[model samples]
Target: MIKVGIVGGTGYTGVELLRLLANHPSVEVQVITSRSEEGIAVADMFPNLRGHFDLCFTVPDVDRLAECDVVFFATPHGVAMSMAPDLIRRGVRVIDLGADFRIKDVSLWSQWYKLEHTCPDLVEMAVYGLPEVNRQQITDAQLIACPGCYPTATQLGFLPLLEQGLIDHRRLIADCKSGVSGAGRGASVGALLCETSESMKAYAVAGHRHLPEIRQGLSEAAGRPVGLTFVPHLTPMIRGIHSTLYATLKDPKDGLQSLFEERYKDEPFVDVMPEGSHPETRSVKGANTCRISVFRPQNDDTVVVLSVIDNLVKGAAGQAVQNMNIMFGLDEASGLGIVGLMP
Candidate 1:
């Protein structure tokens, strides 16, 4: 069994990781850390995991974490960079579900995250953990940078078109809406039930942090820097992301559907819905799957694609587990055969 240690188990992502890894056939949760919640039983904090995990939250210790085969940092951005270097030196593989190692350019990452990176070398060495885009790199990487919820949904929705050159890379628009859980489990007035319910409004139009990450991935796929207008909104729901993307068709590509189908035919998690279908966020809720469908209304020069994912699943913890599976040579679906929850 792969012995696993998790840092910062107080947030939504951390708990979600515990929930998924508990059922993994080849995984054993060895240590979990939380400065504030130290000594508390995992079940006391999350009732859903009552019987599965008998472990308790403890304060983080590098020596203890280094003993595990792999360590997952479910903490915020700066936390991982501060500690991951030590773990990696001790021969432990590291996976960060934060913004620390996701961006290649250290300066840009600092500007957006407002924290100077402590390990620029690791930033360059870390593999962007989008399994569909960098599966091979992940298998050999000691440090994996998992993509954020917005970047995951956005990049998957745009990759097929950009790779096939079916759309004008110079012009792209991503209008996305996400559940409040994307805000994390922190205490904030903006995330209060009264504040978010019965209303929806876009935030960070001036340029969100995920903009550069998305651009970096899209640019990599298109083989050049691409222009993208990414706008994100907070919906009243609990846990999903719906990305509606737009692009100008380069020339009436007849096989856009076939292109997408072929591109993701063998992918275990990305499901390409039939042409003209509109995928629903609820259909992918709690599952590590991105269901996508394409449309060309009136056969016009414009193309629209709808993509949906459970933000906490394919968007965060579940994706981290998928990367872990690849890194350890385990079946990609080892503990991730989750059926989406429906109403």
Candidate 2:
């Protein structure tokens, strides 16, 4: 069995990781760390895990984590970078579900995240953990940097167009909305039920942190620098991201649907819906899948693509487990055969 260790096991992402790993046939969760919640039983905090895990939360200890075959950092930014170098030196694979090593430019990452990066060298070495985009790199990487919730949905929506060089990369736009859980499992007056239950508002219009990450990925796909306008909104629901992407088509072609279908036909987690389908966020809720649809509105030069994903699943924890599966040569769908949750 692959021994696993998790750092910061109290947040929504952490517990979500625990929930998925508990059922993995080849995985044995060894250590789960939470500085503030140390000594508390894991099941006591999240009743859903009661019968699966009997372990207690422990404080973050690098030595204990290094003993495991792989360690996942589901903590906030900066927590993973502080200890990743040591773990990697000890020959342990590392996966970070934060913003630490996602961006290639350390200076830009620091400017957006507001903390100086601890390991600048690893920034270049860490593979971006999008299985559809970097599956081969992830298979041989020791450090994996998972994409954020908004970036996951937005990038998947825009990828097919950019890859074909059919869109004007300079005019790409992503108008995305996410559920309140995307804010993380934290206490904030703004996140209170009364404040968020019935309202929707857009934030980070001027400059959101995920902007640079999304731009980097799209630029790489277009083989040039991409000019994108990304705006994120908070919706009234709880666990998904819906990204409505707009791009000006350089060539008015009739094969847009075929383009998307062929591009993602073999990708396990990306579902390119039928020609006229509008995918809903709830369709992908609680599952590690991105449901996407493409359209040329009015048959004009403008194209619109819709993408949806469960922020905590395809966006965070579930993707982390997917990366772990790839790195360890296990079946990519071994512990991730989760059907979407619905009413």
Candidate 2 positional error at 169, Å: 0.5
- Report backbone clashes per prediction: 0, 0
Could you tell me which 10 consecutive residues in candidate 1 have the lowest summed lDDT? Answer: 250-259
Give candidate 2's root-mean-square deviation (CA, Å).
0.6
After superposition, candidate 1 runs with Cα above 4 Å error: none
Alpha-carbon runs more than 4 Å astray in model 2: none
Each candidate: what lDDT? 0.95, 0.94
- Enumerate residue pairs that collide in model 2: none
Query: What's model 2's TM-score?
Result: 0.99
Q: Name the TM-score of candidate 1.
A: 0.99
- What pairs collide in candidate 1? none
